[model samples]
Target chain A: MTPSALLCQFRLIGLCRKWCSSRAFTCQAAVNQLRREQGATALAGRVDRFGGITVDLADVGLPKDISETAFADLLTDSLGRWKSEGKVAVWLRVPIAMSRCAGAAAARGFTFHHAQERHAVLSLWMGAGESKLPGFATHQIGVAGAVVDESNGKVLVVQDKNKTKNAWKFPGGLSDPGENIVTAVREVLEETGIRSEFRSLLSIRQQHNHPGAFGMSDIYVICRLRPLSYDIHFCTRECERCEWLSLAELARTADTTPITSRVARLLLHGLERGFESIDLAMEELPAVYSGMFYQLYHRQIPSS
Target chain B: MTPSALLCQFRLIGLCRKWCSSRAFTCQAAVNQLRREQGATALAGRVDRFGGITVDLADVGLPKDISETAFADLLTDSLGRWKSEGKVAVWLRVPIAMSRCAGAAAARGFTFHHAQERHAVLSLWMGAGESKLPGFATHQIGVAGAVVDESNGKVLVVQDKNKTKNAWKFPGGLSDPGENIVTAVREVLEETGIRSEFRSLLSIRQQHNHPGAFGMSDIYVICRLRPLSYDIHFCTRECERCEWLSLAELARTADTTPITSRVARLLLHGLERGFESIDLAMEELPAVYSGMFYQLYHRQIPSS
Candidate 1:
């Protein structure tokens, strides 16, 4: 036997011994029986909506000691059975522990679909000419806070240090995973040292093939925020210039990006009239999933 | 040697034989020399802004025949060198071919960060506190289209067959990867058989802990559309009811979702005034990346 297989057998024996300290012979017999059963059983999987099978290797409990050749044999058998059953697609999720088997699966025509922290999912279309499966998240969310000091009709803006043009824009960055719009306040503080609170979501810009987002689409959300602190301790590494500029001047400035200038004009209108004239207020409501909630941004409903 | 390792060596010998058919002795010598050089070379990597080293194993070119023990030894030496150099974090990217090395890296404190089609990225923090490395995309974008017939002051709506509440909502679904807002028009037609054209992006809702999105966040975008075909051949599998409801009644009725009611009120305001009063117009701008463009949606700038 290979060293890895021997190591795995030893580990299993150790586990069994711990479970049944008084009966060593019985424990060894049980381990042998379990190995036999494992070899005989087929890879467990569930049929998806499209008559496809999804096999999560973590749930399959791959034997740690199995050689690559052994894995290939098992996969070959599984594929043969699945083909006979007329499955259209096969999704195999391989955990890190069983990554050695990836090459075996790949050789059998499995291509990567997507991956997460714990595992990678590979797919194969059995019936079709080409796979019709949709790709995973292709857009990145960027949240920017337009920190407005309503008292003076001024809005906080910054120019990036790394840019050639250094055009003025709202302080923001890519939203962290699982972050809410309110997290824009933290980004504003980090970039401009201006403490702020999220007031309302103002605008959303959807763009395709954003270079900064690893060639993926980008969704830029601009939220109106009320400033809590008005200090200019800007981040030297991120921004070359930071200021609270007048709304009118910013609206007409050629030094700013088109979106920034457009937003500035919108803020000017809000300052002149009530914010209710343009604001898309956010409301938290229970999501379809029990115990989960979602924020809905829309025009404020007039209280009767 | 294991069967897999011997197979890998044979493959290399085969490749070398094809490259140099004239000299068998020279080809064997070159292969042996290459293997010796590979064993001595350290894994190559680059430093990030946070003083972290990122090693892409694809670039490292791990030998196909290398054993897990050899990988573990190489990782141990590299970790000791990095720790001595005062590196804060280590980002290791292992391609599918080299996934067998993942367990070796994980044994030395590495954990999964994110992964893509080609490879999986694992990270380890050697810093004083926790790792500041951000996570990958955590939000799914759902696009909905509200097809409005201006002549009749009516909007197309649907009540999902699967939903218990059967509340009226805009006809739409999850936006496909790399899809633009214009794709919402197609979703409207698929869910309800009314053809429509994209008009303007009305509102965006950002929510967290969405159940349908694999426990990730969700961003729901609502776009106003102009209907081309008035006939409603609603999808029986998706919707129980579909109709062109009067905008005024939709704004007042409790039969619809809160967002639908709120948007209906906004539409009413737009109908009374001009669409310019509420519409967030889209403008395509040249992105920072050359030859690429992005769409920016915001309140229309008055033409001077």
Candidate 2:
């Protein structure tokens, strides 16, 4: 029979089984009590796939003062059976409060895999071909700008050395440590020699597969900038060319990327209906936004 | 048998049944041909105790140009039997991309409830209680400060009028519209008359069951501040009293509430080791934090 017909038949049978099994389960409770007189093997603590068992120790806070011998004995007794049964892997997650047990974990061949504020994950492989992975994921935080000179009908644009010929957009670069309010301003100055005032934060963008930055999640913040000087002193190393382009020229240019074009359009729309800029370095969000953007789009602000 | 023992027995039975059903499902694929000869009724879909049938229409993007007669006929055919069957509630989630067919939804007696950026939720009720609810869930975003006088080994604090007799911790209040960087600064000034400089964000706390804020999730961003001046201008309307207390005093005070005490401790800890502050308004998170946090605590941050 066809897959669709088979699926329908399976659904019908499954529905019947669902009700019948639930009833049967309730009725056979007494029968189960009798069956329990004969020894039955107990099931493992978790779901398994590809010959791996997951044991959650999140709630089971092992006694802090337990001896290393006691802990090692417990691990061997619990997991040795599974290993002998040919289980290839085991996964354990421990809460951050119990981080003191890392020494105990290391004794059992378990190694730290990754961590967050509240918890840490560790993995053990019984049948491994030499595990050689980093203990933690790497990440990079960055800031970019969409410097706008709406009054002069111009916007700061840059052509990356690596991008297509004559492709120009906003000037921004990676944020350095302690570069709070001046990150975007500094980038704009370095890229196009324009001493710009960081007007408002436009959006934040994430690139998980950033080519050059492997094993790193690249975070980019796009900001709205107000330019103070128009003198062009472009960086030769990073950009092939940089200039201020009018909205008309930007819309008409074939070299402008879609992202830049869209940003321009959004800025044009925002300027028509002014902008209520969020002060990134200073402003705290109000207690009650009776009717505002936060609720409308969830708290995730738009970004690059 | 005892509850614990009974539970263990059930687990064994469940494991055996899992293998049996999976094997049975595969074997039955070959034997269900005879059942096809018998006429089968189509499945309406899920049944619930509350007499509600949830039919997700997110994938079924109705044509924008579909006629009113056609649209009404379609909805009637789909939901009329459900109504006659006495189903009292229906939920429909329409994605933002498919919002053009809102007219048809409204025509069919659907009302908007809550919304996120990607989608909007709407529900229809034929039950006893009159449904006077917004089509989307409402949320509030707030900012607070954990202002520190690190050099002096003290922190700004206040005793809220609603809290216990002498509970004093950090001075902060609900954020207001356009009250960005100056939120904590403004709050500190208003609460303790300390013109503080906003430094870094310590953490974001969420309270789903905030008193008086019914059906609202209160999101508060706790910030770190550098106090420039120390004067006490307590807001008598909101705060009973305000003061600057040493870290030792804060740690010693038993009257301080758990949240305030925790915040104080965290701020104290952060002083020894500075916080890695992310400016949410100007930062984009990488997409790769998946599986790092959600499963670690089943998706909710640890909050008191």
| C-alpha lDDT of all candidate models, in order | 0.76, 0.53
Model 1 chain B weakest lDDT span, ten residues long: B19-28
Give Cα distance to truth, residue B251, candidate 2, Å: 27
Q: After superposition, how far is residue B221 of candidate 1 from its true place, in Å?
A: 0.9
Count of backbone clashes for each model? 0, 18
Q: Could you tell me the lDDT of residue B218 within candidate 2?
A: 50
Tens-place lDDT digits, model 2, residues B134-194: 1221223355666777787788777788653677757776643223423677877877777
Correct interface contacts retained, every candidate: 0.44, 0.00
Q: Summarize candidate 1's per-residue lDDT along A72-128 as a digit string, tens digits.
A: 767787888888889988888877666766666777878666666667778888986
Interface RMS deviation of candidate 2: 23.4
For model 2, the superposed segments whose C-alpha errors exceed 4 Å read A1-138, A164-166, A277-304, B1-304
